[model samples]
Target: MNKFEIFTNELLKWNKTHKLTNYNEDEIKKQIEDSLYPLEKIKDSKTAIDIGTGAGFPGLILAIAMPNTKWYLVEPLKKRYSFLNYIKTILNLKNVEVIRDRVEKANLPKVDLITSRAVMKTNDILKIIKPFLKKDSTILLYKGSNVLDELQDIDASIISRGNRNYLFIKGEKWAK
Candidate 1:
């Protein structure tokens, strides 16, 4: 079995008890697809951070995809934080750093990219990530149908796949 197979099995086992996620195997597979769909639009980053990496939606998945990039997965909740760390160790992912704290308290350095999935509103995320962004940084937010409402006053590029909205915002566009 591959790493993702192991990841799915572990997630399923933990979900039964800790309820790390409400998604089943098939649903989680769809989420993995949704998480990776925006890779084409993202810039190659040396370091990246994922806020509220609950059940490792895009963080762990992206870490697996982009092993060359350093990834920090932040989760305030204990169960999910444990899961992320466990996955990191099990997968032998040297590029992964599991942070057991809220994004605001993590006090991480500026990174080349920041990602979040269903974490918060676009503007709210910008505020939190302002300190962890470089001028050429990029942000990839996985949002739902209400993404348009969230982006009403925010400048971002959007791509829709099913009901998922991939919001892409360049640091230069948002940092100003």
Candidate 2:
């Protein structure tokens, strides 16, 4: 089994008791691969945040793929945090930190990119992360096929790359 496979199995064990993620083994693996595979555009990012990192879908996978980058995963639930901590410890991931807090409470440092999966609506997500974002920060959101409906209302330009839709909302605030 791959790292994500092992992680999914572990999560499944917890899910039976905690009801963490709704994805089965195949769905979980697909989500992990979808989350981690599209890094070419934002691969050079210095820091990243994954909001509502339920079972560490894109966040933990991103941390694993880009071990050199600083990664923050914000999850409010205590049980979820416990699972995340276990994964981190078992993987020996040094650049990842699981914050047991909601996204609303996240006073995140300026980061190059941010990602979310099954978190919130696209418009709401943009507004939620606005305060915590650097001027040039990009938002990578993973969504189902109907995401186009959500994007039609969003004012930002979007680049459809793989399973993710990347939005560079505004220019980077290199100084501010």
Candidate 3:
């Protein structure tokens, strides 16, 4: 099996004990695909952070896909952090760091890219990460079909790419 397959199986097995994700095999596959949809847009970033990285979705998968870019997986819960750390070890991932703290409490450095999924609303995310975002940094939010509605009052632009809707918001400080 490929690295992703191995990761999936291992995640599922660990989930049995830890309940990392509620997704089944098919759902996991779909989530992985969705997580990777923004890869090209963020491929050139030197550093990236995944906030609330439950089960290491985009962070771990992105780390596996992009070995050169450094990744920080920020997860608040202890159990999820342990699982992410274990996955990082088993995958022999040298470019990923599993952080066991909430984003607000963690002293994270500015990053070229920030990603989150099912974590919070657009405005709230922008507010929470405002301190960690640079002027040219990009924020990629994974949202469902109601993305348009979610971004209705937001000032940022929306870009549709790769079978997924990504809310692309950029600024040093967004009007939240």
Candidate 4:
């Protein structure tokens, strides 16, 4: 089977014991598609951090798709954290790093990109990831129909497909 298939099977197996996600087999498959949908629209990042990476939505999937990009998948929940680590090992994702902590708590370097799927509001996310932002950094937020409402005054561009809104925001972190 393919790597995606292997990853899904492992996720479903772990979910039985860890209850990592409410998604069924089909939903998981759809989610994998959802995770990869941004590749065609965005440029690649040299380094990235995925916040609240539960069951490895866009983060792990993106890491798999962009193997050259260094990916740090930060998940706070114990079960989810363990599951992420397990998948990283089984998949032999050399560019992926699974962190067992909240995004705010984890000690990480500034990255060229930040990605979060079904996480939080656009503004709040910027606040949380402020320290990790560089002038050329970009953020990709995977959202739904409420994306426009959530964008508010944020100067972010959107690319919509089906129910998903890929919010692309440029980060500007000037040095002190």
**Per-candidate local distance difference test:** 0.89, 0.79, 0.83, 0.87
Off by over 4 Å in 1: none
> Which 10-residue window in model 3 sums to the lowest lDDT?
167-176
Candidate 2's residue-wise lDDT over 14-112, tens digit each?
A: 889998878888888887778876677678888988998888878898888888889999999898888999999988899998999988787778687
Candidates by lDDT, descending order: 1, 4, 3, 2
Better of 1 and 3 by lDDT: 1
How does candidate 4 fare on TM-score? 0.95
Candidate 3 overall lDDT versus native: 0.83
**1 versus 4: better lDDT goes to:** 1
The list of candidate 2 runs beyond 4 A from truth reads: 152-176
User: Per-prediction TM-score, please?
Assistant: 0.96, 0.84, 0.91, 0.95
Candidate with better TM-score, 2 vs 4: 4
RMSD of 3: 2.2
**Shift of residue 151 alpha carbon in model 1, Å:** 1.5
Question: What's the CA RMSD for each of the models?
Answer: 1.3, 2.9, 2.2, 1.5
Q: Per-residue lDDT of 13-91 in model 1, one digit per residue for the tens? A: 9999999989999998888888888886664788999999999889899899899999999999999999999999999
Clash-forming residue pairs, model 1: none
RMSD of 1: 1.3
TM-score of 1: 0.96
* 100: Cα error in model 4, Å: 1.1
lDDT, candidate 1, at 67: 90
**TM-score winner, 1 or 2:** 1
